[model samples]
Target: MNALLFIVCVIIWGSTWIGITFQVGHVEPVVAVAWRFSIAVVCIGLWMLATRRSFRMPAHMHVKALSVGLILYTLDYSFLYAAQQYIVSALLAVLSSSVIYFTVLFRRVFLNKPLRREVLVGATLGLLGIVLIFSPEFTQMTAQQGLVLGLLFALVSFVSAAIGNILSENMLDEGVPVMQMNFYAMGYGLFFMYGYGFMSGASFTYPDHLEFTLALLYLALFGSVLAFGAYMKLLQRIGSDKSTYVVLVYPIVALGLSTLFEGYQWTLAAVFGVILVLIGNAIAMGKLNRQLKIS
Candidate 1:
């Protein structure tokens, strides 16, 4: 079950990079993200209603949803969409795996969980693999204006996402229902996105292109709802630290799609990077069959 969830998440999220790229030109990135969550919230809300899931939650849980909405949905995605304008989505996807380290650090500091050596080492190698995978893009950095800023925004997005990951894990540990949490969190996320759009004076134009339309629907339905559902379940099954190994694997998928869409070419370094990522995944999650059964 855990393995299935991990695969589902990786495949969907990896494809979302290409979908986000299609969104780059049609609408303001902030508004595009806002629209994506708007659609996602409605779907989740309907699904919750159909299943008879109660929407009731304590005040603190609402607060948690708000925090997640602001940091994860609003900031993380807002910056991510913006950064795609300045860099290819594959590079941004690769950069995102850094969240593993941040998640681990926050878990250690806030939750008082001791850092496990093997996970850390595995994550380090995974990060290294992603860098090597995108090393060719880095070489062009000298000629790319705003590349540094784009990279900075991507970093901010990853950190915000990592913080949100920790918060969600805590919420799950406290017995918060996943579907209910996502519905409320996405609602608040949509609210924050609208707030940000108004404050920034970003135009709220709807996209009419076929690619953008398809991308928006896919992002909302599969990327936002299904992918997150599977991922959160993985968090429930395996701990957050290990579930994040999916991050390492999905960027490779992003790059694979990039080959066709973004003109990304595979190189010797990239091949070696893939090999390292596989090794790291093995090291990090090698005991998953045992751990899942034990848990």
Candidate 2:
């Protein structure tokens, strides 16, 4: 079940970059994100109602849920959407994986979890892979201030997401159902983004093409609903330290898509980097050459 959830999440989120790409010119990034989450909230809410899931939140938990929602959806996504304007999607995808390290840091600092040496090694190799992936962009860094800023914003977004994941994991430990938590969190996040859109004078113009429309739906449904649902489930089952490794795998999926659709050339460096990434993930998972030894 965990493997299935992980694969589903990777495939769905991997394809979401195409959807996000189509959203480039239609409306303000935050406004588009707000609409996506708004639709997601409604869809998930209806499903919850149909399933007869309880909507009640404990007094202490509501605040934490809202706080996590704001950081995860509103703040992180706002920066991400804005950063896409300046950076290549592939670079952003790679940089986003750094969340694994931040998740580890938060775990060690607040949760008193020990930082496994394997995780640190994985993080180092993964970061090196990101550098290789974005080496061309970095060459032009002096001329591309916006790109530099975009990378910074992407890192900021990553940190916010990592923090939110840890918080959500804690909440789940306290007995919160993932779906119910998402519904309320998404609702609050939608409101937060809506307010930001209004303040920024973002327009509500819809895209004209069917491609964009379908992409928007895909992002709202599969990306936001299914992917996030699976992710939160993994967080609950495996804990944040392991769950954050999903971020590491997502770039590989994104790179595959880029190769297929965007004609992205995979050089020798990219292949080596990918190997490092896979090895890093294996090391972090502590599954390096280990088979199930049943007595």
Q: Report the number of clashing residue pairs per model.
A: 0, 0
Q: Which 10-residue window of candidate 1 scores lowest in summed lDDT?
A: 286-295
Per-residue lDDT tens digits for candidate 1, residues 1-295, read 9889999999999888778878887888889999999999999999888989899999999999899889988999999888888876447757778888888898898777777666777788888898888888777655467888899989999899888888888888889998988888889988889987899898887766888899999999999999998998888777788888888998888878778876887999999999988878867775543443322
The C-alpha lDDT values of all candidates are 0.84, 0.82
- Please report the candidate that would top TM-score against the real structure: 1
Residue-wise C-alpha lDDT for candidate 2, range 27-48, written one tens digit per residue: 8889889989988999999999
Q: What residue runs in model 1 are displaced by over 4 Å at the alpha carbon?
A: 259-265, 286-295
Q: Model 2: runs farther than 4 Å from truth?
A: 133-142, 289-295
Model 2 is weakest, by summed lDDT over 10 consecutive residues, at 286-295
